[model samples]
Target: MIHLQFRKVHGNEGESEAPKRSAAARKSIGLKAKAERFASRNGSRSPGKSPKGRVPKRTARLESDRTSVASAIAGTRSTAPPRPRSKHFANAVRAYEAAIKLMHAEDFGRAIRSFEDLIAEHSEEPEIQERAKVLIHACEKKLHENER
Candidate 1:
């Protein structure tokens, strides 16, 4: 046989089927209530407000910002895209990338040869030529070390 204890929900108090909480939990809840009360008395707003139906202040500012930015961009629109540094830069870049790929695949001899070809053919693009020269040295060093 089992027995149960029932507490009455007195005058203005409508109780539900929730279990009793511990002292620490109740104390923390009371502190939160006090914080809300203090925040209300001051000019500060309480946190975790419902955003339903009310347009936030930032929405207005952001809309204005969007219109202004759209107008400014329209005022400064251009017809043609920007040009590259040089005409042969694309070919040089392609060759350099292929050489680097060969070096990564451990074909250092072939990589060295490819980089040398890039350096010879793309002398107008000095930056790519310089990088190819550097990679050539690296490939040579790696190749000789592996041969030993």
Candidate 2:
């Protein structure tokens, strides 16, 4: 069923609701409409929308040694959604990041200690442990240069 309402126009004729508004009002309406359309389209294609027999990129990435510091630094990464991480793994990452931050801040002594702690605490994380070993050497060299 359809209902039609007829309004008598006093001055302007054949004008749409879109055109009747001021320029800013029209612009706002256009943007809002565009955003709504985009959201609807994006929702249909979102990662979890079809998650059957699929390993999310995050977990699958960690399954290989390819998930290393070098790849992260190069920004050679995927755009897929991340799988949830274990508490232990999350803690390990936090510790590693903290050490890296200290290294970036040029606090080599503390960074060395922190990286060593990460290696000790997260030995199950071979990728992290290997990277930490390499970074420890870099920190050692930096300390040596400073002492000279």
Candidate 3:
């Protein structure tokens, strides 16, 4: 002989399903744990705090180093001499004046040649070189128009 009996169980007769977490939530949780471990290893009281709540003695040394650096800079500044005026300035000015005079006299060929020589000789004077180049272009244009 066999007997059958029914017993009451939880209303939902299924495996308990945990609430699902998104990928971003999982990554955030992992990052939080890693940060906590890193802080503890470094003797920090909290994630955003300095270790042991004490200022390191290096602050004093840093102050001394800063003063030494400042003095060294000042010493170098005192020892260095001021720059002298360029020796080529007078010559460059003279050549530039001559080129301008030739241009005004309508001697385009000579003016262009003088400007070109100035550019070749005093490349260090960029302002003069640029002016000479523009004048040379103007002289060439005039010469071309005269030809036509």
Best by the lDDT measure: 3
Which portions of model 3 miss their true places by more than 4 Å? 1-84
lDDT of 1: 0.82
In terms of TM-score, how similar is model 3 to the real structure? Answer: 0.43
Task: Please write out the lDDT profile of model 3 over residues 13-123, one tens digit for every residue.
Answer: 332444457999979988988988987798676645655657556888999999999998987775556556587977998999999999999999999999999999998
Worst lDDT run of 10 residues, candidate 2, spans 1-10
Model 3 residue 148 CA deviation in Å: 1.7
lDDT of 2 by residue, 17-54 (tens): 32356889869988877877886987754454676668
Better of 1 and 3 by lDDT: 3
Clashes of each: 0, 0, 0
Q: Model 2: runs farther than 4 Å from truth?
A: 1-84
- What overall lDDT, based on C-alpha atoms, would model 3 receive against the true structure? 0.83
**Candidate 1 residue 84 C-alpha distance from true site, Å:** 8.0
Work out the TM-score per prediction. 0.47, 0.43, 0.43
Q: For residues 1-148, what per-residue lDDT tens digits would candidate 1 score against the true structure?
A: 0112233434223335555679999899889989989888895766677556786569888999999999999989876866656657877888899999999999999999999999889878877888888989999999889989
